[model samples]
Target: TLSQHPDKNLHKIAHTRSSTGPLAERVRPNQLCDVIGQESFLPESPLGRLLVEDNLPSLILWGPPGSGKTTIARIICRVTKRYVVKISATKAGVKEVRIIIEEAEKRCALCQPGTVLFLD
Candidate 1:
């Protein structure tokens, strides 16, 4: 079915999120300084430190809609030379997630860098 269950519908309120598609591409920061509008968060702060360390733990990016959660994920990957594979719960199912996960595992195996699995 091309529909979602009530409690799990991400698209029900995709306000500022780009509707182009889910995880269409990794949006790398244009420059180290191009990441704008995050006073509380810094480029090379604790999060930056983690990215540099290449041992970022899994996290649940919680916030109201349009809080730049998606933007931050890309910035994390950019700063770490890492790769983030975002997937929307509404547009994707377990099977698709599993497939991307397998690919991510391969990317991980090489110790390429950190990968942020952003979900909404």
Candidate 2:
């Protein structure tokens, strides 16, 4: 059934919003260029310059609740085009972390590219 749909129609359907999504989800930046504030840590900054050169690193972003830690992580994953495996520290346990690590390892072993494990 999915294969029967036209590609153009599928694109339109994918972009259509349900209107029930959270305000944050609705306004979230889809690209790094759209993200405002945090000028000192963006791609033009010293830290960002280093990250741009080496996108694969275990990074820890600590900030207040609304300070865009998640946003920055999403942008990093997007810019690098790396697979993202998100896990909330409040909800996930060691077993979940181990599974994610195993999956990431498997992806690496297959030469399928690396992943960004975003611990929210």
Candidate 3:
């Protein structure tokens, strides 16, 4: 689990060299402080404070290509101990979303970690 205090862990996320993915995924920042260019979302910042206090609320992150939007969402999930369900809006239709929501509901009923839908 991540430390609630944002200033503490300014280190990179640990992963094995065997992990395979796109370059961005391989190099993604696991810690909030390790994320660059989005200081407003850092733990010391207001938004970061809100996240620490209230947990993650529904949000639509907008940024240019290669920005840290996906990384931020995944980090939030880790911090909150939630399972992330990533889907691209262009590929997933309403039925697919409904299916995810239903599965999430089932997980919630089983007292599992809540789901964080990361619609890209």
Q: Pick the candidate with the highest TM-score.
A: 2
TM-score of each: 0.53, 0.67, 0.66
Angstrom error of the Cα, residue 112, model 1: value is 3.9
Residue pairs with colliding backbones in model 1 are: none
Per-residue lDDT of model 2, residues 1-119, tens digit only: 32365544433443464557764665566555456787755677776776577555677889888888888888787677667888899999999999999999999999987788899
* lDDT tens per residue, model 3, 5-115: 364432233234335665456557877888889998888898898778746667788999878888888888777767789899999999999999999999999999778
Q: Name the runs in model 1 displaced over 4 angstroms.
A: 1-40, 52-54
lDDT of each: 0.61, 0.73, 0.77
Q: lDDT-based ranking, best first?
A: 3, 2, 1
Q: What is the lDDT of residue 1 in candidate 3?
A: 28
Worst 10 residues of 2 by lDDT: 6-15
Candidates, ranked, TM-score: 2, 3, 1
